[model samples]
Target: MMASSNAIEGRHGDASPPKASINACLPCRKVKMKCVIATHAMECNRCVRKSLDCTFREHRRGRKPGTRLSHKSGSSISRKGRGDMSTAARSSPRRDRVSDFWADSEGLQPDSLLSHQAMRGKFSLQNILSTDHGGNIDGVATSRSVPPDDPILLGLINQQVAMGLFEYFMEKLNPYISQLDPLLHTFPYAREKSSFLFTTILSAASKYFRSELYPVLHDHAEKLYAECFRRGEKSTEIVQAIMILTYWKEPNDTRAWTSIGLAIRIGMDLGWHKLRKSARDHGGLPDPEWREIRNVERTFLVLFVYDRSLTLQTGKPWMIERNEFIESVESWGEESMANSNDHLLCSFVALRLLTGDAFDLLTPHRKSPLPRLNRLLTILQNRIEGWRKKWLGAVGPGNCHVFLVQFYGAHLQLQLFSLPLQDTNIPDMDGVGDIMPFWVSYQNSMAMLELVTKYFHFLYLAQDSVHVMTAYAAIFLIKILLSAPSTIVREIETPTIQAISDATKAFVSQCAPPGSSCTLQARFLEKALRDYSSPRNHQSRPLVYNETDNQCHGKDGQVSVPDSRVEGRESSILSGLDLCDQTQDVPDLLFGDDGSWADLFASTGFNIQEGVFFS
Candidate 1:
């Protein structure tokens, strides 16, 4: 398996020839042949013979990494790649502000924002800046009070304070997603590798913990981050730094997406995605080189998962093609098992893969009638159940926290297929039972609801509590309970909904200060749930509405199905994308890919049966 061919290209169109450089696609590169773009040339000669899509995309943006931005006085500097990053300062670093959501609280009721499409909840640079906690806070205020050239913010931290934050990052945050744990922990040794990466980690830590230093550290990170990429995008350290920065501040940090894009391109440049062949050819490469290569391969796999996670909801496009291999992930899993060091990362990868599958199986393009979709759902569910059993066995019983949070995430992404079905008002959807049992969908939904209920219980206990997936599950339950026809919602006893709702409210409040980006979205979702589950609405219906109705209902008893189902302003396009914290913003990536990641880690011992490949 190799990197996903169905990946999302960088901000520019598909092919970014490296700055002042020309390169061949992987196939041509492998053969050591020149890959030239002749007039009307799409595929390199080798790719055409192999019958593979000739997608030679890379992240070489308008200016290659390392090229300094040509700054203009008093104008917003157009940094290469997407340098769109920032956030407005609320009264307190932790307080919510109106500009964050780009609307006044007066006009925007939480219930309405959620019940109507959560357009404002979509991940955008605007949201990242408008809600960011950084300063000299120009990204948020857009005032340009400070020069973009300033990379150092005095008093950002001394060696002692820096260590405290680093400790916090290592202890509190690292355990949940530790792919780059080794690199992160050795920052003291690697700072010279890239100061931007070092500062970005601290900045992310400060933001994650909601330290007042978030603004200063973040500004320093933004300045140097641009510089790092400007120097060159191919340095493996740059990719690592981008991953760390993304994990530190995401969802609202759209700049992470740009960096993520660069990392993907750089991964391609180093041939990190398709390494098995490279390994065979580089016979003389030293053991240390192989180890480095393996790590690079793993990093690429993680990024591949991240891309799948994002596209699932935000409806963001992908760059990798469906035919790209995914063996890389498998290879890492196998290697990691020997040491037990990557047990958590394996779980993390597996959970996202399930979500990626769910996205592919359920996305509208399949035009898959309800019956076919149900069958796919069942098959995928069975696979997930297998993965869960294997994951628990691999992680062990003592590591209950890892097992539970990841499994909760699995339930959220897999069962999410039912939500779109529940909310979709497609007539003849009721006829779904003829092809397979209709109860299957409801059962799955109930399973998800139950997971949310389970998650609520574990929320207080799970260290490094992952909120985004939990939030997704919470909203899933709320949406079903709120809008689901009476019959289906009835199976969920009022007590269950009440408990879930109560738990959800507490969950939102818990995340408020030192908050996650999804807090407001959660609050809005909770409000919607409250409005729907209110005594008036519940009692207004005499008996459980029969599941016979194919239509998804609106506030009125009238059947109303939106044209696009649950596509817009709802979530990642591809679920527009998280792995760790950054990918969850695109966790849809962990959920779907063009098959490149599978190729990259193919020997990791996990593979979708050939018959199961969707699209």
Candidate 2:
């Protein structure tokens, strides 16, 4: 039993520790008996104390094949390696030799093979980055970067610049275009890049040049034209630029005429044949595309060819040869089949510019040379009158009601300017007829007067009345006195003059604010007296103070004391003191006791007929 116990102890206790051998770890190959992963420095306390290799075969009994193979390197099988070898075997040298024979016989570069392979690898990398990695390192993003020489983008930017330049060019060149200098700094680069920017700039410079910049603008325009022509870009756009330049040139320059002629020739060559044919066949209306082209052509033609002041110069009428152009225009109108609105408007503007003074020249002739002018004027007059009636019916009875009133006024002014100044007694030309020249002028003047009065009335009634009223006071005083007719002057008998004086006194009292522009007001009142109280008092009738009262008292009825003596007493008393010495002969009712007509006339330096002279 003792021997058996000793054997058990010997077996259990260690039996001389079994020659303490080292077993390298399959993963680490370090000196130790305990497993030592390389990540743990290939050492364990138990192996170090035993003085054995701190190594152990990776535990594989319960682990996966992949885990067991980690310690063996190439000792394990690989499906991918097996498949690759199989593929190589399938594409062996026998097959490659046949492909090489065909490829070599073709004499193609063998480097293409390597290049294609490299390209495939690059494409694969790009696809991987773009699809799987969400990176933008590929060439697609960089391809969209704008280049300085790109034609399309440059053209678009140039167009934007052109639009801005056209709007502000005149301001840039003319110091007087605006008093504000800050306006110039607002848009600088926009003016530099646009093609049409030079046109507007030259236009403004020509329009407002203070005689000093005339030569400058002229030289600039010439240089611009030469540059465009030299560039071999004498397109329709270049022609338009030249035409605008010519328009702003000195009116009498031979070069101006030559430039205009060249521009017209170029324009006609571009498409004027089709334009003229379309205009004639279509009756001022053509297909939309053709019409747009025609409109641009006509705008250039109008700007280049026609000058109203020049047309009116009798000595140089033939210098411009306006009659030929007018004949052409008339023929174009007759041939046109479709009448477009734009064409009609352009025709109206062109005709007015061409024939404004021809009407006057022809009116006195035994035979009218311009029957077509008469017809065109009649048509325009009717259209304008119809439009005026429509607007009048739509608007209310306030000053704002006349917002569109200027359109009618301008049309009438054009018509009046178109009338002949000859003293012909033609029935149609007489002021008594339905289409009478004087009747139209009178109507237009009346409308303008009404508008002026309404505007002043608005100022008087408005809440913030100071500034607006001051502006209107100057405008109204100027319009009323300056625009009234000589006929109206003659027909205002003593009664009408007296009534007007009373109204004037009332109007003046309302404008007593010292800050207003009262100089015009004072001058108007002085002029009215001087004009109405002259030797022509026999021709003048006093203004009617009240319409009802004037109507009730017949023209031949017994005389009533004029309302001027009663209504204007206070204003005349205050204002007459200043004017008493100069206006003593004028019949002022302010100086008399009880404001009697005779006493006031005697005391206030009143004269019945020899009117006051303010100046």
Candidate 3:
């Protein structure tokens, strides 16, 4: 039913001699259509009809053999040069071409990585178009111009607070959350910068401001966050801002999850995740440019760690896959400023690795098990301990964030081991020894509770606790205490939990502009603790004396009898470890292996050694 070829061509039959189809012009290639250029035509038919110029541009070569080269690059010689007239000129061109091929060979590209990242839109040029800021920012076009408020006036009223707030984020929250640029010491040209980060910093710091100004500061932050996001400006600062705002969300709420994912997507488009490799390509860049590159790396690291931690927490599958840049976090070195909290970043990278591995070792969460649970746990603990030893050596007076993460990672190790506790099929009736070695995970849990106190003690002396870390520590401690026997809690540790709860409430009090997510989380945890400590929550019944009854019944129809004979709740921290039968007794050799470091701490008591930061 289709028209014959001659019939289709009747109108222009022999007007121009039939010419072989050449490579598609750039305009046609951009839209991915065929090119039809007559022998004498200067432009492709599509461009001729559309009244547009037909351009041809050289592209970077594709790596694979038989790779689809740009249409015009199909032959060894370009169309214009195909019939070379001069042999002497050809030889000179050949030498230059060979030299150019091997030039700038310092950087390495993993061929395997390209294909993998490609699926995630790694090489798309669409991001290149959007990265110019104007294309990205939507809705309100005013952002394309200067801010409505005069920069001079905005700075004047908030100068002292703004500078201190930026430092606060850099110090107190940044190490814990890891979002701010490490290089920028103060707010630099705020009116010209991305309002998102500026407002977010002010909003976060607003919680700590005097009550009179809290509402004003927080409102300003909220408006800017809304405007910047609603009208997206393509800048890396947008990514930074998204991360800080995510921290402001309630713990476990998916409200800000989407925003973070967007930030990561934009970050990848900006090639922030690939900054290290790209930076390596251009050696001898200025210090400011290098700092910008470092900022991207640091920001990407923060994004990676936060994304993974939340993934692990929620039992959701990971969004970003592991990559080489993340692995290089440990080996890469920086000449950090004095007390720059650089150790925290290094330790954090190491800690994130443990969590990434934790993702795999975790049952069902990971696809399959390679190293057995015991093997995995021992490896992780030893590695974490190694990390602690390294970071502790460098700990300054203001190292609370690093200290918290050390214990937090340790807690996560045990927490991973206890993942089976969540499996409904696994009975947790006489909880003490059923799921995991109750005494062991319990010790880590107890140790975590102690660490919470120490974490705050350090915060109180040096800096304030970040809401996210505090909430995480709160979640860890509460999970244990929700069912734990009141009697088993140390007389000393009990007061610490109370102190945490009290401090949380005090934080709640100062949380201005109302409904601050961190303060709300603190209030919720405080109430939960208050309920747990109520008189009615404690068990009053005497233990049954029946010979057949092996489990001791505790509060609210639960059992707390400690026994080491239990199986499957294996002592994965170290192999061949057996606990002393008594509930209160700890083993002489904590891991049953010689030189178990835990035993040294047990013997010496869990006290912070002089000049030692953390064990």
lDDT of 3 by residue, 437-509 (tens): 3344545655554564455444321222234334444444544443344454333234435444444433433
Tens-place lDDT per residue, model 2, 236-337, is 445555644543333223354455556555544343322322122332222442343444444443542333322321113322233434435534434332
Highest TM-score: give the candidate number.
Answer: 3
Comparing 1 with 3 on lDDT, the higher-scoring candidate is 3
lDDT of each: 0.44, 0.34, 0.46
TM-score of 3: 0.56
Which ranges of candidate 3 are over 4 A from the true structure? 1-146, 149-161, 167-175, 249-254, 273-282, 335-339, 364-372, 424-437, 457-526, 533-538, 541-615
| TM-score against truth, every candidate | 0.54, 0.32, 0.56
The predicted structure with the larger TM-score, 2 or 3, is: 3
Query: Which candidate tops lDDT?
Result: 3
Residue 438 error, candidate 2, Å: 2.7
**Where does model 2 exceed 4 Å of error?**
1-235, 242-274, 277-295, 301-362, 367-380, 383-420, 424-435, 445-487, 491-615
Q: Please write out the lDDT profile of model 1 over residues 28-75, one tens digit for every residue.
A: 432335454332334343333233323333322355333423433322
Candidate 2 local accuracy as lDDT?
0.34
